[model samples]
Target: MDIKNLSLNPNYNILVTGGAGFIGSNLCEAILKNGNSVRCLDNYATGKPENIAPLLENPSFEFIEGDIRNAEDCLKACKGMDYVLHQAALGSVPRSINDPFTSNEVNVSGFLNMLIAARDAGVKRFVYAASSSTYGDSKNMPKVEDIIGKPLSPYAITKYVNELYADVFAKTYGMETIGLRYFNVFGRKQDPNGAYAAVIPKFVMHLMKHESPTINGDGSFSRDFTYIDNVIEMNVRSITGKNPDAVNTVYNVAYGERTSLNELVELLKEYLGEYDSKISNVEIVYGPERKGDVPHSLASIDKAKSLLGYSPSYDIKRGLKQAVDWYWKNLQ
Candidate 1:
């Protein structure tokens, strides 16, 4: 679906926390182009200033360098903002496992700070990034919003807590809140060089350099990899959607199909190979599955479709091809 179809009022003030990160920065760019004033709040804990560097030139864009862990910072960012898209948090399960305290501080406590700030600021709606990890150990094939399993890691716990806090605040204060539970999101501007980089970008980089990409646990694990534009559409709907049923709920933001690790590698190689045929000749390696790894994950985006009118335009192959092209042009 064309993003311009969402059609939020041009003059409304929107605040996107973590607006210097991959998904958040994309949202900022889309919102600004739609003629809205955008305020970006980021401490750069995991976000990059470079992601939003090009965005700084827009007079309608405002950048606030601050941490969400500070309640005062949260309050200042929310003040006068009509809508709040809270995306600031330390992502990655391994990173959370390595440091749970900091993860809890930012994802949990910091989320609370944003909630309070948005509530007090009288923001019309609070749309935040939730996670598929919240499904945890459920073993369900197509994860639905109502059913969930116990959290498997610190990151999962924090994301789940965000849902609970958002629900409570909505009930207690009569605030409008929506959560988008993202599933394996990837696209341009996703950092490919990190100890906890996402598999798609990391593997793309590995193959681009003619290096072997390792698969964890025999390459059978799977995920519902959604594209950035799809995620951007959902965030826009959460703010502009007028349905009362869509408010005060969480919807899975995904393409609704699972791709195995083996298939994922093959697809990336095929797409990247178009740029450098030698990448197709790259070797594959195997390793023991890391801790906190789920065997497979898929989401039921029915709720998003029925309520939020979400229509994801890209599947794995299409999104991967676009991503590979971006990495070749920008990163290589």
Candidate 2:
């Protein structure tokens, strides 16, 4: 998972939109580790300043406080960049359900702004973060790239539109683009507080306080829980990989396995119990099934492997252990 060994251009100047967020900040950190320059653009709407505070003094790191929804800001951020890692978006199914207009504005319209800016700036490649929610109602156990069902939520629709836009930009503008459909990515620096917080980090924070962590369904719902390091490696490969066929296409970024919600809670308890013995006594609550939720989601990463040479370095257990240790050290 060490991206410093990747074949990145030494003189590369990469622009990472939403670079104050979890995955975006990690991309900035990884690129800087490879001795490349990175320009970070974020408005701190969902991204925290503390995430990138330590990187402020690095000579290779540059931060721009801007919003992607503004076309002018997008143009300014895209300036002087060899590559663009576009990760700026408003993410959450329930949040989109409540406010579809804003979701469409940021995820869809804002995405278009970034693409136009990247194309106009003559950026080499555009690597973006797509989501597994695009699979929608597809009952396929392992989701492949070519097959997808109709989108179920505003968030899913926005992501699907992003893929469509990327494809159109590639064909019409001759822009090189890669879309990674991430499957439940989790790890360090992921926000555990928020009304729309992800299940893993929210559950960890709750369990730390010896509180009951709620499961949205009957605990049978499963996900292809990918680790952050694995995600970072795939992104780096998408940019540095020399294969021509890999460009202008989408790939699933996952560990190629699924874990049920019930099993996930148990594993978290086991890991956290070692740090505080009382954590094992915390309970789990089962709530009603949520809207726009699929019963199961597992990704077939064969396309990524065959094309980009993707090899996941961490399974769920190993990743959870690392995350638990990090939370215990930093967030406790």
List per-candidate RMSD values in Å.
0.9, 0.8
User: What global local distance difference test value does model 1 have?
Assistant: 0.94
After aligning candidate 1 to the native by TM-score, how far in Å is the CA of 161 from where it should be?
Answer: 0.5
Q: lDDT for model 2, on a 0 to 1 scale?
A: 0.93
**Deviation of model 2 at 250, angstroms:** 0.4
Candidate 1: tens digits of C-alpha lDDT, residues 1-332:
24678877888999999999999999999999998999999999888989999989999999999999999999999999999999999999999999999999999999999999999999999999999999999987799999999999999999999999999999999999999999999999999998999999999999989999999889999999999999999999999899999999999999999999999999998889888999999999999999998899999999999998988999998899889899999997
Model 2 lDDT tens row, 189-280: 89999999889999999999999999998999999999999999998999987899999999999999999999999999999999999999
List TM-scores for all candidates, in order: 0.99, 0.99
lDDT of 2 at 128: 97
- Maximum-lDDT candidate: 1
